[model samples]
Target: MEDVISLSVGEPDFHTPWHIREAGIESLEKGRTRYTPNRGFIQLRQEVSSFLSRHYGVEYEPESQVLITVGGSEAIDLCVRSLITPGDEVLIPEPSFVCYVPIAQMAGGVPVTIETGPENGFKLTAKELEAHITERTKLLIMPYPNNPTGAVMEREELLKIARVVEKHNLLVLSDEIYAALTYTQEGHICFSSLPGMMERTIVVNGFSKAHSMTGWRLGYAAGPREIISLMVKLHQFAIMSAPTTSQYAAIEALKNGDDDMAYMRGQYDMRRRLIVDGLNEIGLKCFEPKGAFYVFPSVKSTGLTSDEFCERLIYSKQVAVVPGSAFGPCGEGFVRISYCYSVKHITEALSRIRAFLEEL
Candidate 1:
């Protein structure tokens, strides 16, 4: 096990950039440790507003539309708690992150999974969205640049889904935590920025993925003023404020972390290409992912279930990748390999996988 090559986690291998870390340290040195606003510092919120506006063309009023949470996880929990009523159905696209469905359930809302297939690059299609909508449907969990599958929704695709959402008057929780890691030529498309979507969409994002600041535990949710107001109230009563030091550090991230983002995304892009090609050559059919740091390859060719394949691979080759069934039932025939490690690390893992496949 000491020689195991683990590719199961979806965090960057890079350290937080010096400037961002320095900002956190500076806050400590200057004694800026007291709890700030329940919605977080006004300056950090303003920076988030400006960053989104400049990069994605989505303008939010920092004072009214933004509410900072502990992380994207809390933002999701807060939005679901604030908006959902018992028995309300939340449309969650399958083969996505694991949290959305359970969080919806904890809010006493019904979780309805809409299975997304690799045929459409694993994206949640307009047809799929429309098919899932019913009289009880209240919200859609749009986790793009998606986890496990690394699926990203294109602009035209978003427009198509947005039309369905508008028709049903469904609210959307667009989790774009991996928005900055997209490897597409046109870059990541912000879901809420779609026409007629912003007003009905809650955009949840944070510094963890983009800034490699996972331990800092900071994220923000932005949406219509009325909804955000309720979310802020929930935050005030439940968790008081986001960490004061992290909020100050996030200001630095939103303001000056562009170059760091490019550098990390570039590295992930290389590893993405390497793993996709390696898996395909080794007989697993991999759909080319346009975003995020994962490559999901079908294990059906090996005549093994997703769990069986992962277990055998780990035990035999000392290489670990997640069984995609962990994401959703629709993911049962696939395995998710994260490309967040170095090129050398990924190369060794690929070689081991190839050898394992040959031995089969």
Candidate 2:
């Protein structure tokens, strides 16, 4: 096909807002290019602290509970490294973002994958979580508003898991990068907001998804002071500071980017409904995604594995989507369709997928 559609990419389609770009440009022109403090620029950290507390009701002291990293990815790495020792077990719910397992492994920890399926709405249930815990379990990677599945844990659901976590004495590494993209009627609820959970949870969030600044590489982690200190020490030796221009741009994002987020979220929300509805209408079983910009639809009816389905669709129809199996084993019969494209692109892609599946 001369023209193709891709639903595999994850970043927002919108460009960084002009004012945020201008802030970065201003920083560059002013020769503010020196390395910031290892933890991060104080102003940016303060802005992040305020943003988290204001938006998520999680209070983090700017000086001690926050550390700016290269991105949410690096923040995750720091948490796993700071908390995991050799042979320690990290519990990860499957059909998740791909980085958690390898990062835990690189940190000298073993990753134990728990299969979470559509029957549970792809959520990590309290019983499932409790079964996975042992004295060896050191960390749990809570990735919701999830990446491929777009599953979000509301407050009630999180509270159930928190009770189990408290019983097991587990430390949680919560990835909230997509918190701003949740679509449920109740909206997104951070695990940190649950009672008795914030003290034991390390939260990773960023401007990438919320502010359309992925390429800028600005993200941060917030938690108790002691854990944050260890993360900062690791950050100090590994990387002295995050990007200077990105940090300046992030300050602008925190201060004046709410409108931009609302506009972008409105667009993604529209596309999210369109794609999920279209997939269901096409005979694919799509779990209504309540958060993030992806639709994880079951392709089992197509008589093909997730990888086979993706390959055939890409080759035959020139519509690219990622195989859900790439996320984890439980994702075998599904595929992740990202809504980070234009409306026209989403419509065309869904149309092509429909035609392709009908042929089967």
Candidate 3:
């Protein structure tokens, strides 16, 4: 019996780089474990501010506009909780990360899901944005370089969406956790960097995807002072602060982890191409992904639901991939395959999938 080939993980398979790890170790060695501030260490916030401004031209004040959180997850929770009131509608693009809708519901907001499809590279178009907005709509959860589909919105596309946002006066929580992993020559554009967008967009990013720092439990949100201040107060009451040693390590990651990011992104890109081509050759009809580490391939040709396909594949071939239905109802005909694993592992998984398809 062969071991299972698991590709459902959303994290980078790479370990946290050495320098960042050493920084965390040194912080602990020096007894830097005490709580810093409810907003997190001042220096780490400063680094977060600098990193965003330097790389994406989106500026936020270290003192007031940046609030560190346990992870991007908590930042999402904080944003939703701070802004949502009962009966307020939150627009969430479907086939997104699982947390957005649930968090909005838990915060007393109504979640309105807008379905995106492969016809548009799974991107949320301005038309889709316009169609979903009601007078009650208060927030738009934008998860680009999207999770299940690996979709990325370019600057021109975002400009159109921004126009809709401006027209509707909607606040956006842009989850840019996978920002550094974009494959386009133009790279990832920070949503807040667009003219007239800074005031309405809360950008949530973290060290997890880019630095392979998933265990570090560090992320930050940058936005207008008013929104950020409220988020900070909520964070202070609910969680107090993010971890101290992780903050120390994240400073090093922000300053010195570029080369490591490039290396891991390059590897993911290779596996992405491999799995995409292999899937298409096996008649799965995969779209080429432009960002993130996932390939969402249509398994409709097999005449099975996403959940059924996933179950059968894992049982018969000992390979694991997430059903797209696990993301949302619109994802029912697809399966999400992660390229975060090594080429050899991806190759083996593809081989197993091919055999499974033949058997079906």
Instruction: Report the lDDT tens digits of candidate 1 across residue range 1-360.
Output: 879999999888899999999999999999988989988899999999998998899999999999999999999999999999999999999999999889999999999998988888898889878887889999999999899899988898899999999999999999999999988878888888899998999999999999999999999999999999999888999999999989888999889999999999888888888889988887889999999899999999999999999999999999999999999999999999999998888999989999999999
Prediction RMSDs, each to the true structure = 0.9, 1.0, 0.9
Query: Per-residue lDDT for 197-276 in model 3, tens only?
Result: 99999999999999999988999999999999999999999999999999999999988888898898888888888889
For residues 100-184, could you state the per-residue lDDT of candidate 2 as single tens digits?
A: 9999999999999999999989999999998888889989889999988999888888899999999989999999999988888
Instruction: Give the TM-score of each candidate.
Output: 0.98, 0.98, 0.99
Give lDDT per model, in order.
0.92, 0.92, 0.93
Worst 10 residues of 1 by lDDT: 183-192
Better of 1 and 3 by lDDT: 3
Candidate 3 residue pairs in backbone clash? none
lDDT of 1: 0.92
List of clashing residue pairs for candidate 1: none
Q: How many Å off is the CA of 237 in candidate 3?
A: 1.0
- The true-versus-predicted C-alpha distance at residue 46 of model 2, in Å, is 0.8
TM-score of decoy 2? 0.98
Compute the lDDT for candidate 2. Answer: 0.92
